[model samples]
Target chain A: MSARLACFLPLLASLAVAGERLHCVVIEVPSASLPLLREEMKRAAAPVADHGPVLLSTDGLPRRVTHRGQAPFVPEKPIPLGNGPREGSPAGARSFNIVAASGAGGGLVYDVSIQQSPVPASYYDFRTKGLVAAVPANRWQELAAWNQGTRSVSLWHHLQTDEPRAAAGDELRIELIFASMPDDALAHVPEYPPELTRQVVGHLSGTGRVWKSFSLACRADVPFHLQSSHGDRRRRQEPGYGDRVLAKFQGRITRDTPGHATLDGLLEAPRHHEGDAEAYPVSSEASIGEWRLIVLRDGPTFKAAAAAFHEIYTRRAHVAAKVNVVAIRVSVADEGEP
Target chain B: MRCPFLSRTSRWIGSALALTLAAAPARDRLHFVTISRGYDDLLREEMKRMAGTPVLPRSGKLLTGITGFPRNAGYQGTIRLDRDFPLEWSVQRSGTPGRTAGDFGFTLGVMRAGDGPGLRFDVDALESGTEHDFYRMTAESVPLPLGRNTWHPVAAWGSEYNQGMSLWCYREATAVAASTATGIHLLDVQVGFLPEPVVAAMNTFTPEHTRLARGAMAPWQTLSVSCQVDRPFSISSAAGERAMRGRSDDRGLCRLTGTLTQNYETSFNLKCQWQPPGGKKQPQVRFDVPLQPGRWHLQPVEGGPRLRATGPKGEVRVANVAAFRITAAEP
Candidate 1:
């Protein structure tokens, strides 16, 4: 049979079940160590990737440009300072603001943020080549439509400064990106829901010398169906490399896990005619529906992300010392085959 | 300040009249309300113009009530909407900071009617737009009260809220469904509610973020210019944002006034921050000003942004006012 399916009507009529659901989780991190923690995030974040992190800021940069009753102005150039610092956007806006100001003496003469202009061909090329690009100037995403289907967690102070007693003024500042786990603890996962799409469900516990902890019980399914046909007019777009409907992976782990772990992986690409969803049942006529994930250390970046999981682990890499990378680190769970 | 609702004689008369009208209709005597934080007292006086019953501007703040619904009643845990955000929240990723705005404004809360009031859910702390907010919890949810039967229970209310309450995903304070529950499966169980003021307020401050020109009432002069100075040239290691001061001799006057356009809240006051505007460390000064029209402008002082009064040593005698619009205008 198919996995748990969720059907949403365009409007609020012709629906019989109260299948509505929501989920929330809190991230607990030590507070005092947030300063040092920020450095790790900076180092760990994708380096000048295809896109820059939103609401992301660097520590120690002075926001010099400003006018009374105006936004703090920043220069278009990348600013670097000693300590790494930044404030993530509120869970909804999804981005932080970097105000760039110039001409302080004669008043603000140029503000590209308030108006729109054409970008050069060079700008377009940068984006296509996997470099960070800005949204069209002087505009913001619609506060309502930008994120039509996701939930987030509040960035709460998990508590770094809490002390065991007078003898232990030891400060352990950590940053937590508290957010809801993937929606529908058990979704009728689409053969083609979004990807980098993975999920983890399990107990949350503390681990590591720094007390870093996480779980690998979470599970997420990347779109094997390649459902996007917006570019094609032929037969609702061709199916992807997989002729499957859904792939579910179930596993378990604890706080910051380091390397590899065991997982009962299931790959099901059910073969059925068009409208066979309701009556269609998963058959033993299954193909190679299982595989083993041997996760080495963090792959050349997230390459090893597939087997990339551990329980309550920590590391002291040559580049990143005293860094505590947790087990719940999210990676786009993938399926490989020759 | 003399709001019609504040009148001793009007309260009794208005309440009595509202009661009489309430006898016949559901929402009858809910008179008119005009909220203006725009112009000088000119906009403030609109509340006084009410013939009788009137909803005053900010008679009170939002009365908060808390409730959290568990995905499953038998389940050990509960899912409660955040308080800060009327609806749910999400952390999103953007190409650049503040360039792309996200859609966090959606149905923050929902409830369906039963015999009387419906089962409700309140969404409070929404995820601010961040990586977690955007790719994370973006979808919102509300629970329905089954009352055991799980069926035939009429859904009397369902809708969205955020400003104009009708705009920005229905920013209304509350919603009520139509289609009398004559049956037929809660008939017209609908989603309807406008964004109220508080919802509107939530939309105002976004980490993702604007601009100004002169007002229509008083167009920005190509002749006049402005720039701010923090710490007014202090050689100290630290210089704060401080508007340098300016002044004119006996007969001359320095004015800092501006008009506020519609759709924009009128400012409360224009403040100066710098204790000094000269000396060192490039002056570290930043400040916010609450400006209003009709009359504005700080009294002129030496060594300020507006030191030169559009003339030779404070010589210009131009009759002008400082004004701004919700939108940025051309220079």
Candidate 2:
């Protein structure tokens, strides 16, 4: 047997077969609050059940005011449910029925399922409307639990965020609130050691193709590296959208310094059209944008962090572009942990 | 009571059967791989250089093999293609030109059990979260090998767009040591590319469709052709003629890149309009122009007005020009 196969044999043995019952735990937090919750759990080394205050409203707009008395924006429709631009996570449109609702610590809690009828389940969210976050039958396979019996053991929770259509931002943030099955469950849930995981959180925003940066505390024992979730953003749509120029962000944190870290941004704006196709990519002009972040640790607490942003814009395609960064949270875990 | 000779004969037969089983061709390893231009490397370097001065940073997250099985340098995996049934190739598509981040970055190459021109059902590359890599590629089922066992490139869909960082999939076979009966094939499959390098190296010019002062001329109008520095050594001009040029810097990076746009069915000429450095005349190179993945139709333009093509997963694409017939340029 290959070494990889041999190493995974034990993991395979721990998996629960189809007939077995699993204890499933689900947790939902604001898309932005996930990092904080992760940090909380990392320090405690136990599953966290309840996290307070949804940062964004049910409509996915930020609840906090940019200015006082800024009226809330009620979206006419929820984000489309078909395949997102990002890969993975089940595709095809799915609808859920809210079978049950109750008052919970976070706000109103509802039990929702893909089934047309009610099933025995409970999930937490801030509002009664807008299906917040859900794991479809297809995703249950990843959690290693059988979808049929999971309804009883699973808890559904909604994630709040502020992402408008046709804008450049982090759109779909799906967090598994928590999944805990008994030792004898039908599926084997993977676990990571406490020391290797760290949650990096911050905010990034800028205007007119210029990227900005924000710094956050870094408490990782290892050099901070890029995670797949760090680059996840909603697909933007606009004229010249097919142009290659766009915005991107990068994170830099190292264990050498200990307490400090930062997240930086790179932005690009389309200058002019170079070629044409009826339904294919057209060439355009744009400059490169690059940024970096680093953190320094002092004593027991992470006290210092710094970020830097640099952009190369051309005079030709000098158009204004806005980058609205939501609360950016990055979860860094051991590569072998999953 | 069995005789001693009968028992000895049975033992001998069992040992021979075990040896035959161990030496079977099924035990040979099947290697699957992919090779594409390192577009992401070019983009990252260009971005850093464009932002400021060049500073080489430690490379981030080298692909640990083909996504799921094991972390290795290149995207590769080993399994018995016959027994393993469906072998998957999970490629990480880190955004490139024509492909965006978050787009489904997958390439589906379907070939018959033997070999020939196959079908490229689908190809998509976009930026995505790491988790998506696990399910990015959809492994199409291949029939058991028939009689012939050899390594060759299967002409799948979009096999032409190999310039820069486009997908160019091929396979090779090697015989097991001293065993003519046993053979192992390494399938090197290059999937997608990064966006930055394509932008830096390639540029398409304006107006794919235009007319002369006289009136509307041809059914298919030749828009413009683009040339770049690093890739696509040649370009196809009007009427399927080819124009190839060569120029290089001190680093020997001389690659003539070109682009030709078509609206309907048009004819044009291929000409070496410009000379190389030192103004030396170069011989015209004849080659198949690799086409980028676009809305290319399988049917002929003259057949009907409506041409529809569906991907492996049923994604729709509409295009004209079934195949290119390159001819010598008329003087």
The DockQ-based CAPRI class assigned to model 2 is incorrect
Q: Write the per-residue lDDT of candidate 1 for residues B1-331, one digit (tens) a residue.
A: 7876569788899899999977743331111111211221221121122223223223321111000011110001112222232332223323335534543222224333334433323222212222222111111122232222111111111111111111011111112332232211111101111112211222222221101001111111111111111101110011111122122111111112222222244433333332222333223232334433332221112232222223323443222222221111111
What CA root-mean-square deviation does each model show from the true structure?
30.4, 29.0
In the order shown, the chain A TM-scores of the predictions are 0.17, 0.20
Question: Can you write out model 1's per-residue Cα lDDT over A4-70, one digit (the tens) per residue?
Answer: 2223343223321232111111211232222222232222221122334322222111111111112
Q: Which 10 successive residues of model 1 chain B have the least lDDT summed?
A: B65-74
Model 1 lDDT at residue A5: 29
Per-candidate iRMS values, in order, are 20.8, 22.9
Tell me the tens digit of each residue's lDDT in model 2 across A1-338.
69999999877655522212211233333333322322222222111223544221211222221111111112331222212232233322222223222222211222222211122222111111222122121111111101111121123222222231121111112111111111111011112111111111112111111122222212222122111111111222222322132212222322222222233322222323433111211111111111111111110111111111111222232322222212233322211111
Q: Model 1 segments beyond 4 Å from truth?
A: A1-338, B1-256, B261-331
Each model's DockQ score: 0.01, 0.01
CA lDDT for candidate 1: 0.20
lDDT of 2 by residue, B34-141 (tens): 333222222222222222211112232222111111111223333343443234444544553444443334443333323421112222222223322111111223
TM-score of chain B for predicted candidate 1: 0.18
TM-score leader: 2
lDDT of each: 0.20, 0.23
